[model samples]
Target chain A: MARLVVLGGGVAGHTAATFAAKWLGKEHEVVVVTPNSKWNWIPSNIWVGVGQMKKEEVVFELAPVYKKAGVIYKQAKAVSLNPEGKDTSDKPFVTIEYTQEGKVGESEDVEYDYLINATGPKLNFDATPGLGDGSGQMGTNTVSVCTAEHAVHASHELEKCIQKMKDGERQKILVGTGHGTCTCQGAAFEYIFNVEHELKKAGVRDMADIKWISNESFLGDFGMGGLHMKVGGYVVSSKIFAESLYAERNVEWLIGAHTSKVEEGKIEYELLDGTTGEETFDFAMLLPPFSGVGLKAYAKDGSDITESIFAPNGFMKVDANYDAGAYENWKASDWPKTYQSPAYKNIFAAGIAFAPPHLMSKPMQSPNGTPINPTPPRTGMPSGIIGKAVAHTVCDLITQGEGAHLHEASMAEMGAACVASAGKGLFTGTAAAMTVYPVVPDYDKYPGTGRDTKYTFGEVGLAGHWIKHVLHHMFLYKAKLKPGWALIPE
Target chain B: MSIEEENFQKNDNFKLTMLPGAFAKRMRTCVVWQFIRFMVLNIKMLIVVSKSH
Candidate 1:
């Protein structure tokens, strides 16, 4: 029987493992290796950060669910890939280090017929000084809601700041990217607004000064060069929508900023204009830049093959047009349709683990020659979709034999729905529920914005708020492998 | 800040493109008006999605 080993167990890895197990079932072996013990519904981490939701509500033990799904779940972090096996054996195997209780730091080599690298990102906190404790862990200078634990910490910090505000203290709140090359401007957008919402609810709105700082060239470039949303009958640009939203909410912004360094209550930043400045805040939640989880790959003779298997950023190289050149020349075709590795046919990558051909936004470099651009966003809906598609291709190859057709899911051909929460409440809350057909801009197919305007829609109101809340529950339930879980769309 | 704005936006080869105002009027609100209008829009979207596949 063919053995399939999947690395990482985020949205991408979990989806791939479960689906492959179900499809292959008892005939082929499916193993999932992830460092985390719990599966987190990451989108709801915003609510958790604001104390709107409990950490338990967003996470569930992954082991039990994998057990029910008939997939071998290993609580371990992948260390290296021996895609060409060793001099002792011709069989390909992966080196994994256990992160679970008791077996922590222990290593093992497991053989695999096929490997799916969905190990996600390492949350490169070291990319900037003071973002991390100089050793890849988040520092105390700022709080983050990128992880469930980080969200819990952020929630407590936010509470303390609110208390200070209520006690006659005028607190400055800064929220956005921790570094220039960071992505997920959307999360920070949702977060800053949610903080505003929470402050208003706490009756300390007037006491707190909430400000946004981001790496986006424009206000609304949520990475994919800022999409145009069809609001009501008008095809309004997201820039105008975001600008008006910020103005209405009294939220001031500094765009095109690369936060260079962080210290207690202060941060030094470089703007796109080559100007340097500093901002101080009582509470800051900045997203650090992302990099590959640093998995090394070696050949049969133990020669380093990491350069051939991975990009400089350490993300696995898939079937993508890496030589797409400049922003003006970038095409949607540069995105991977079948996430197969060009070097090893037995390996594939999906989600954040895969190296995108290039940044979705126009790449920019500061006058000092430091590149400060928003990286491509691969989260939630897109990650799960890519994961499932990769799983489908892998299962077909394993079950139906070598000549079977591979399933393809291209970012250029798929649509994504994002419900960015501004607040979390039944009737009082609101979110911008946006739908973009084909996340990647297809300049050849649609020209201008490279999007089909008819299908790209967005609206903000209580309905969106309710929908986001519903999605939180639904996705968590699906992740838990509840009855009728497979019916839920990625 | 001013220089940063000039640096980022000023060098753009194409002028900033704005969307048509036909659908703009319906966008600006959050209370009862937005609630009713957006609910209808949501329903219409649900129908569109259901019909698409």
Candidate 2:
């Protein structure tokens, strides 16, 4: 029987492993290797960061779920990949170091017939100065909601700031892009608003000065450029919507900024227009840039095929047209259809682990040659879609045969629904529920915005917030492998 | 519905704003015309103010 090995157990990896195990059944083995024993619903970690949710509320033990799914689960981190196996065999094997129980640091090589590398992102906080200390954890200075544990810590720090504010001490709050090339601006944007919401709820908003700083040339440019949203029966660009939101909320902003360094209580920043400045803050929630988990690969001859296996940014190279240069020249066809790696037919990448052909923004560089543009973001909807698509392709190759036709799901052809909460409320709060067709722009189909304007609109009200709250629980329930879980989309 | 329809339904009073580049050349001609008018007005104003002085 062929063995299908999946790496990491994030949204993409878990979806791939669960679907592959169900489809392949007992005929083929499905193995999942991840460093964490608990699966975290990362989106809810934002709530955790704001003290609105508990850590346990967002994370659950993965062992029982994997057991129920009939998939072998190994709590280990993949060290490296030998796509060409060892000198003795042509079969591919992955080397993993265990992180569970007493077998910590113990290594093993698991052979695989097909592999899905949905390892997600490395949370490369160390890429920026003082962000981290190279241990894959956030630094002691600033806080992040990237993980549940980090969110918990950030919440604690926030509580301390709140207490200080209660004692009549004014606190300066800064939130947004930590690095110039950071992609997940949406998360940061959500976080800043959440913090604002929480502070206002605590009655200490008057004592806090909250500000946003980002690499986006304009506000609301959530990686896929700014989209036009139909709000209140009026078609307005996200730029205008975001501007109005910031103005109405009294949250000041500085766009086109590149955070250069982080010191105690302050951060050094440079703007796209070549101006340098420093912002001091009592509390900061800066989102770090993401990178591949730094997993290396070697060829049969031991020659480093690292370049062949991965993009320059360390994300796995898939079937995308990497040479599709220039923003104006980019087409929807540039995205990969099958997600199969060009180097190895049996290997595939999904979610943030897959290297996008190009940035989504109108590629712009600073006068000093600093490439300051929003990196292509493969957020929740796209990550789950790609994961399921990869699973389908893998199952077809295993069950039907090697020549089985692969399924196609391009980011440029799919639609994504995002519910961004302005504040949590039943009837008193607000959220922006937006739907954008083809998360990536398809210039050939929709010339100007590259999005179907009809499908791309946002409505802000109490109902939108309710949708976000429901999505949080629904996604977690699906991740837990509970009853009727299959009914949920990947 | 098409994007135009969705947009129109969302905001009945909203006017479509074209990209700045599309009318840049035409806008330059208008700017020249406005500049001549401003110059003539200023010259006339100067003459009136000088006579009053």
Candidate 3:
């Protein structure tokens, strides 16, 4: 049987494995290797951080779901790839170390006819001093909402801070990216406002001070360099929209900032204007930057060919123009359409596993030579869409033979809808719902803003919170492989 | 004022803040208005999702 192995089971890997299994049926083998046993619907983790939802609400067991889909699921972390096998064999295999209950640390090599690398980000917390425990995990000084467990911890910390506020002791709260290269500023943005709302609900609004710090050169640059949204019959930049929200809610901000260090109750940061400062807080929730999970590759002679197959950052090399140097020379066409590795046709990468050609934001560096800019965000809607497209191509290759046409889902051609929650109450809650077309702006196609403002829009209200809540349940249901799940759009 | 507050004040963001009017703020949570908005917003999102495929 033609075996297909998908590494990592986040949004991308899960979608690819499940769809490929259904399409290939009993004719082919589909194996999914993921370190975790549970599937987490990440967006809802923000709600979990505010105690609006529990950890169990955002995550579900992956074993049962895979079983129901007639797919083999291996609870293991992928270590390396031997794409050229050994000197005696031409077949390819991936080495995986089991993290499963009974087989913890047990290593095995599984041969594959095709491979998909969707290992996602390593959550490189150690990129900044004191941001990590030095063992590749979050540090003790601050909390995180990146995972369901992290959100649970963050919720408890927030509760303690609120209790201190209730006792008439003032507290300062800070939330944003921990490192300059961090993505997912949206999560931190949602969290700070939620904390503010909860403090007010607890009758301690005056006792708490909240502030935002991000790597974005300006506010609302949720990495695709910010888009112009048509709001109230006028096209307004996200910078204005975001500033309005922050100002209205009495939340202050620090932009063009790279959080350089984290210590007990204080953080040192460097700004774009070559200035450095320190901010102190009683509570902090800062996200870490992402890197590849460090999967190595070897050739037939067992010589390391990792550099040929993956980027320097550890993400797999895909069908994109990597040499597109200089910001002024960048083009939308530089984005990968098929997501297939150029050197090996049988290998592919989806989601954050594939390295992008360059930064979507205008690259900037401090006078001290420290790079402080937000990296591209390859999560949520775009990740799912790319996953499904790659799955389609894999299935076609198996069924329609070697001449099968590849499917494409380039970020440059994709439209994304983001509903960023501000707070969570049925009537009192608020959120900003935004839509952007052609996420990677094409200057030649749409001149000024590089986006079609007609298809791009945003608004904020109680209605948005309801939609965000609805999506939480809808996405979970789809991930659970419920009946008619395919009918739900990615 | 604190140095941080002054740092924020020096920026031109204050001039661009679009604080909704009293009527607009009331409409944001008005059951009827929000219900209509809920439907319209979903339709808009569906359009975006459709074009993406």
Candidates in order have lDDT scores of 0.86, 0.81, 0.90
Name model 3 segments beyond 4 Å from true: B1-16
Model 3 chain A weakest lDDT span, ten residues long: A419-428
How displaced is residue B3 in candidate 1, in Å? 29
Q: Write the per-residue lDDT of candidate 3 for residues A1-490, one digit (tens) a residue.
A: 7899999899999889988988999999999999999999999999899888899999999999999988889999999999988888888999999999999999999999889999999999898899899999999989999999999999999999999998989999999999988888888888888888888888998898888999999999988899899999999999999988887777888988999999989999999888999999999999999999999999999899999999999988999999999999999999999999998999999999999999899998999888989999889888989999999999999998989999999999989888988677788898899999988998999989989898899888888889998999899999999999888998
Clashing pairs in 3: none
Residue A121 CA displacement from its true place in model 3, Å: 0.3
After best superposition, candidate 2 residue A436: deviation in angstroms? 1.0
Which candidate gets the maximum lDDT versus the true structure? 3
Tens digits of lDDT, candidate 2, B1-53: 43334333433222222122324324323545434533443343233222211
Q: Model 2: DockQ against the native?
A: 0.01
lDDT of 2 at A198: 84
C-alpha positional error of residue A369 in candidate 1 after TM-score superposition, expressed in Å: 0.9
Q: Pick by DockQ: which candidate is best?
A: 3
